[model samples]
Target: MLDELLARIEGRDFTIGIIGMGYVGLPLALTAVDRGFRVLGFDVDPDRVAQLNAGVSAIKHIPSASIAAAVSAGSFSATCDMNRLGEPDAILIAVPTPLDRHQDPDLSYVVKSTEAIARRLRAGQLVVLESTTWPGTTTEVMKPILEAGGLRAGKDFFLAFSPEREDPGNPKYSNAIIPKVVGADDPASRALACRLYDNLVAGTVPVSSSATAEAVKLTENIFRSVNIALVNELKLIYDAMGINVWEVIDAAKSKPFGYMAFYPGPGLGGHCIPIDPFYLSWKAREFEVPTRFIELAGLINNAMPQHVVHRLAEAIDKQSGRGLNGARVLIIGMAYKKNVDDMRESPSLRLTELIEARGAHTDYHDPHIPVIPRTREHAALAGRQSVALTPEVLASYDAVLIATDHDDVDWGHVVAHARLVVDTRNACAGIDTDKVVRA
Candidate 1:
């Protein structure tokens, strides 16, 4: 079984099945198809599957032309059927591993995906989990489920873990070019996973155990979360001193090797930084280890939305002599970061909720997101459409809050027309006016 699977992988004559066709799985499927392998994408969302099958792209960064090309080449297709799980020579799980309401590591999605694959377990197939999860999940959680069907891992089938490194809208990187870290308990599973990704990506970094690979991904995100928290703390400190944190960072980053600039924003966002740190913290409690630094960083990052909202209220009161109550505020950007429509763990949603909680009315303007869709936490913000950034629209607002630093917006137009602008991302850096204030 191993030799046959290896030969098929070498010859590119095998099918690759990917589960959870979102930001990670779809790109992986497209990359595999580009590498001369047939690919199948599985998703629970019927609408998403139908849209992908009809050659429409669900993600904004990924073009429809690419999906259309993959479908036209007969190498890629999306489906909601889990019964076809055993048909592919290799199955990759790229599902979400979000934290629960209590901020505990939620592996429900991962567990469900594994259960579906276990029902159709077959020999000569490799199963690799690409989800960012707790360190021992591949072996501790998934192994038992996959072995429940009377097949052994690394013998009847192979198992590995390789976390996905996907940066949406980052032109410099893609799933196919990023170096993958592949690890497994057995050498055969590790080699097979490495060989597969080496053919798909730029290179592979092999590790001794799946736990190490899992820890590597968590550490990466934790590093980002900590640095962002540091800068966020610095932003507050410098604000008290009446010093511009953005200018300080711009100059401090000029030192080539010593400083890597991480800007302070409204708060953390995206799939990894906001949520992946808690996965490790939750797992750390199993061994009675206290992750104080991680928990502190999480606290600091979580407090940013409230700080921005407070600043908005203060600015509104100072300028208009009125509180957030009965104020009509316009948020400049709706999506988490810049030039992307992904709002997975965005702080903007919390800002909207907080602003409304204080009796202020909130509207948003985003180039990418036309109408706000329902989110897991911010479902009440559903169906709210993006308003235009016209002169009349800008003038009508009590305060224009710049939450995201998307390059598509006109800062000049906003400052020229709005009564007051509260800049959270330092989006309007050089605009010197009493109407514009950095939050």
Candidate 2:
């Protein structure tokens, strides 16, 4: 079965089925089609599937022309139906593994996708999970569910875990340029996964087991979370001492050997850094261990949103001779990062609420995101449209908070017209105006 699958892949005769056609899956599907393999995209959202099938992109960074090219080639297709799940020679699950309300790992998406695959399990099919999850998820959580279909993972079919390293708006690294890590306990499964990825990515790294692959993903994100937390903590301390944290980072980065700079922000955002570290912390309890650094990082990073609001309040009081109540404030960016329209775990939502809770009328503008979509939390800020940033509009606000540093905004106009400007990202650097305050 394994040999036949490999032959199909090598001959470009096999079909690739990707579940959860979101950020990770869509790019992979396009890459696979470019590599001369048939690709089937699966999504539970009928609207998203329809958009994809019609050569339209739901993500801002991924252009519709790319989707149109893939659809025009006739090797790529998307559907909401699961019965076609049996037609693919290889399956990759890239669904989300978000945290639950209590900050625990929520494996509901992984479990459901696994269950769906188990029902249609067959010999000669290779299954690889590309979702970021806890170390034991692929083995302990998914293996049992898969075996319940009366097919052994290694013998009858192949199973492996390959962590997805998709950076949404990163121009330097795409799905094909980034190195892929494939791991499995079974030799055949690992070889098949590595071979498949070798064709799609620039390089392939083989690891010992699925657990290690899972740990690699967590370790990468935890490193980011901890370093960011350190910078954020230092920013608060340095602010009290009247030191510029951005200047400190510029000087410290001169060493070039011992330090890699991670800037302080309103808070941690995006799907990975904010949530992936908690997976390891939650898993550490089973071994009677303490992840002190992870816990501390979580505490410091989580506090940054409120701290930003407090800083904004202070700026407004000092610059304008009035309190936060009845003040009109405008937020510059709503997305978590620049050059993309993704808002999962965005700190801007919290900042908006904190500003509004203090009796300020808050409005936001993101060129990428025209309208704020409904989130599980922060429903009060949903359906809000982006406000145009004219010179007249900028001057009317009691304070302007730069939550995200998008490159498209006219910084000169903002620095010139705003009554009081609180810059979190050092975006107003080099302006050297009395009206601008770095938070």
Candidate 3:
């Protein structure tokens, strides 16, 4: 069985099914198709399925031409059906692993995906979980579910964990180029998973166990969260001392060795950095061990959005000669990153909510995201259109806060027109503006 599977993978004849066809899954599916594999993208969202089937790319980085090419070639298709799972030689779960209200790991989506796959489990099929979650999720939580199908993991079906390392809006790396880490419940499963990924990606690094692979993904995010928090803390300190943190980062980045530059921002955003670290921290509590650094970093990163609100309030008070009450503040961007439309765990939403709660009228402008869905906190502000980025409109706000520094936004116009500016992303750099304040 293993030898036949390896042959199929090497020959690129393997049919790859990617569950949860969102940002991560769509790119992976398209990359597999580009690498000469038949790909099936599965998503519960009917709208997403419709969009993909129509050759329309929902993700910002994925080109519509790629989707059109794949669909026209009959190498890729999107569906909401679970019964089609039986056709794939390998299944990859890219479902979301979000946190609940109390910051606990929410495994409902994972469990649902696992159940969908288990119902169609057959011999000689490999299942890999690519969702970021706590360590042992593959070996402990998903293993039993797959085994309940009257088949064992290593003997009947192969299982592994390879966390998704997707950086949206980063042009340097794509799904086919990123180094993937693969680990399994046993050596045979590990080898099979590695071979499958090796056929598509640039490189595949195999680890000892699925737990270690899971931990590797979590650790990477935790490192980012910590470093970003460190820079954010430094930003506050430097601001108090009247030193520009961006200049300090630029100077320090000149070092050739032992230095990695992480810029300060409104806060840590995106699905991975802000949320993935807590999965490990939550799991650690079961062993009576507290992840102090992870907790501290999260605390500082989460608090930054509120701190931005405070700073914006101060700037508004100073410039407008009034309190936050009835003040019109414009947020420059709404996406988590500069150029992507993804808003999962975005700090901009939190900052906007904070501003609105403080009695300030808040509006945002993003070329990428014109309308934001109502989240838990921003439910009242749903269906709001993005404000125009013209100089005259920008001048109408009492203060403008640059939340996400999108490349398409006219920063010079914003600097030239806004009455007062609070830039959390240092978007106002190189612009001659006395009204600018950097967080």
Q: For model 2, what is the alpha-carbon lDDT of residue 249?
A: 96
Q: Residue-pair clashes per candidate, as listed?
A: 0, 0, 0
* CA deviation > 4 Å runs, candidate 2: none
Candidates 2 and 3, the one with greater lDDT: 2
Off by over 4 Å in 3: none
Reference-based TM-score, model 2: 0.99
Could you give candidate 2's per-residue lDDT for residues 1-439 as a string of tens digits?
A: 6777777788998899999999899999998988899999999999999999899999999999999999998989999888888889889999999998999999999999888988888887889999999888999999999899788988888899999999999988899989999999899999899889988889899999999999999999999999999999999999999999999999999996989989999998898999999999999999999999899999999999999988888888887767688899999999999878999999999999988899999989899999999998888778999999988999999999999999999888888888889999999988988998877
- Runs of candidate 1 with Cα error greater than 4 angstroms are none
- Model 1 earns a TM-score of 0.99
Error of 3 at 409 (Å): 1.2
Clashes of 2: 0
lDDT winner between 1 and 2, please give it: 1
TM-scores of the models, in the given order? 0.99, 0.99, 0.98
Model 1, residue pairs in steric clash:
none
lDDT of each: 0.93, 0.92, 0.89
Worst window of 10 by summed lDDT in candidate 1: 1-10
lDDT per residue, candidate 3, 1-439, as tens digits? 9999999888887899999888888888988997899999999989989988889998877899999899989999999999998889999999988889888999999999999899999998999999999999998889899889699999999999998988877889987899899988799999999999998899999999999999999989899999999999999999899999999999999999999999988887788998988898899989999789899999999899988888888888887678688999998888888999988878888888788888989889999988987776457767988989787898889989999999888888888888888999888789876889876
